[model samples]
Target chain A: MHLLAIDWIFLLEKLILIVIIISISLGVAMYSTWWERKVAAWIQDRIGPNRAGPLGLLQPLADGLKLFMKEEIFPASSNKILFLLGPCLAMLTAMMTSAVVPWASHLHIAGRDVPLQIADVNIGILYVFGVVSMGVYGVMIGGWASNNKFSLMAAVRGASQIISYELAMGLALIALVLHTGSLSLGVIVEQQAHQGYWNIVLQPLGFLIFFVCALAECNRTPFDLSEAESELNFGYHQEYSSMKLGFYLFAEYVNMFISSVIMATLYFGGYHIPFIHIADPNFAALAGFIFLFAKTAAFITVFMWIRWTVPRFRYDQLMNLGWKGLIPLALINLLITAVVILLHTQH
Target chain B: MNVTQILFWLLSALTVFSALVVITRKNPVYSVLWLIITFISISGHYILLNAQFLAVVNVIVYAGAIMVLFLFVIMLMNLNADAEPQKNKWLQFAGVIAGGCLALVIIAALKNVDAKARIAETGSDIGLIENLGKVLFTQYVLPFEISSVLFLSAMVGAVVIGKKN
Candidate 1:
């Protein structure tokens, strides 16, 4: 008699999980800025952001408010719609990537077993790459809409860099996909948890190439040629102000967080620490979330450390590393992996 | 109609709308962006048919990489609505004739396609990667490898030409 039979409970569960994950991602990205400053301060022998709150914990909140309160400027010569579209697109793509990532094992709550993920789609890896590639529009449209030459230059650089690294990144990911034989992130993580060793043990070179590509992808230091202050003058977001600029900056951190989570999922055994077994399923799920969180935190710290430690790469060097170095290295690793898999199967 | 039908109609409208915008836009950057939207909506249609692999690959390759290069070239040229070159009347007439001929050909080609005769394929797994991969590697491996060789040669040609220039 009903028009449509619906699983309302399932719908409600997903809604709650969505809210929680979004909050966690935003919260983590906010704190990551604090952590980055603290790391930078530590490196330079200075105490950072003690005045904002305890350990400058509220600095991000302060920053957010300042951004919100700031005046918004639409350039007289700029395309108004695209200028606004840029930041929103960036933020949207950043948030969309979390949809395919399996955050943890199944959770037993409200008398129903709920997965701690949004959508564990079959083409999860491709979905991530597609959404990430879409992220270039944020920079491209934003910079172009600024009607500034430097902004245009930055956008062009960013678009090219992202396009190049995505090649190497896809090549690197192919080796892992070949090893796992599944594009689903959930399935890959489950395989790693059940297997004795993580994929990193089998594919270290793939991990390295993937890591470098990730740095380039996120526009992080050393690979951040598009945002080179000396040459491009703050790069793509140069004309963006108010909350729009904040969104661009926030999207970058979210991207970094997501990439680290992806690396952990693909290489590190995600939530599974080998030989440490927990009998209770619910507790195991909770522990898995914690483990995944800890790994991402470690990765974020490493990202920050690299940002402070390494000097930015020259444009040509960056291109050379991606094209000549990582691409060839990834190709070799892929070949080796194929041979190994083939040999093992013959036995 | 149900949700699937509703989604089909919605995506069809979106695809047509975006495609029209792509052609009509004065600014090439905006045109490219609209074309990207058109491709995305087409990908949505692929997903509606449960062709997950094709849907994602379309987005990753066509909408992501190819469209970005188009956008890059257009943006670097600093072209705008005001800068768009005017076309000649006879050239425009010839262009219209060509496009109309293409539309006619496509329509004639698809006129024999009768979908209603076949059973509605609900929950078909043929579009899934596992099935696609098996069929492709086993039955269509020769063509697949040949296309890849074609792509490799194209890549080499591009690199060689760029180096020489």
Candidate 2:
């Protein structure tokens, strides 16, 4: 059988790794919700969920249980299949982005080298961009399927907002891509490690633009016009209930976690510790994993911090900032990078 | 069949099915969603052919950006309800006949082609981003630059059309 030509052991190893990474992502996303609330309370000078378990670490689990027990409501006038499909797509795209992220350097175990990523495809950054773009559909479909005027309006706002910011985000990323000259996330990280300077140092303006666009992309504060409560009354997910609603909310946190990881990977030198060196490959790999996790966690905290600190933008203001402010800035950054690279190469 | 062949067949079937659904769906929003599914299946085919960059770009451009715009316009028009006006019976009949004739012509044109001979293995590295970029810059530089100019003009045209007096 030609199928026998495939290495079963390697496939088994990858399957196990996939399972581990997925569960870890879910666990991190669960805790991020708890962390977000706690941070919000702290910023507001109030005690956060302390009753659940050790600083309310288990609060997310309780919340999950509550959501599950809540009654699922399908609006009589709503499109049933599309309504359900919305959150499912949101969750699916959220998880899909993780496939290209390299958690750590390869681990050498039992004389076999195991890479930490799922698929090290050549277009890793583009793959993430593609999946991130797909996330807009979840909001658009959910809002339109609700058969509510407000929801439809919010969905339209969301689709335009995402499209506007995505151009700036792409241009900002192009500057970084020029510096690294590779689309592979692993290669980008390695380049940063070898160069001993993260992309943020060279592309500070690009990073700022990218970070702002990331906030807008994730529908977080300052750019969260899609879900502006006072204006649109909870916006796109207004008709969602029970675990269906939970999935949408959970998907946001998951997207937050994944984007944080991407930001850390792209700008903060991924798994490369600043001044640490270990001779042993195994020890180095372990340290890289821990360092990458620490970086991701720090970024997640920043996301929550900004979410609590900033006010949501008005819809027109959001659109203006995305189109007028970020896009031109990103284009300028790209041009400057191109010129610098050309000069450097000539010299 | 081998795994690649099996995957190709599966993706082809999915793409065809979704394309049919895209045309047949009564609701325009549902038609747009099915169109997205068709694009995704086409991307799957690109991946099977080892063109990872093309696959991801296809999803990003077609299924993600363009389809979202399609859905956005559909929602803005409030066309989720069954509002499409049925075409005249004779016009519909003519449309079907024309479509069938086109299909027959395509099949006939390909009938004498050596399909097996053309099914040779593609260069694996040709689809990699590095090689693609090199070729684009060195060999196709003029066309690439001209395409950007075209996009710039299109953007300007859109702005002009969208501006309020």
Question: Model 2 shows how many backbone clashes?
Answer: 0
- Please list the residue runs of candidate 2 whose C-alpha ends up more than 4 Å from where it truly belongs after superposition: A1-4
- How close is chain A of candidate 1 to the true chain A, as a TM-score? 0.98
Candidate 2 residue-wise lDDT, A1-347, digit = tens: 12536778878888998999889989999999999989999999999999999989889999999999999999999989999999998899889999999888888899989999898877999999999999988898899889998898888888889888999999999999999989999999999999988989999999999999998889888888888889899889999999999999999889989999999999999988877788888888889999999999999999899989988887878888888899999999999999999999999
Docking class of 2: medium
lDDT of 1 by residue, A1-347 (tens): 23545567777778998999999999999999999999999999999988888888899999999999999999898889999999999999998899988998888876778898899999999999999999999999998999999999998999899999999999999999999999999999999988888999999999999999999999999888888999999999999899999999999999999999999999998877678888877999999999999999999999999999999999999999999999999999999999999999999
Model 1 / residue A327 / CA error / Å: 0.2
Inter-residue clash pairs, candidate 1:
none
TM-score of each: 0.97, 0.97
For every model in order, the TM-score on chain A comes to 0.98, 0.98
Error of 2 at A15 (Å): 1.4
Assess each model's interface with DockQ, reporting 2 decimals per model.
0.73, 0.75
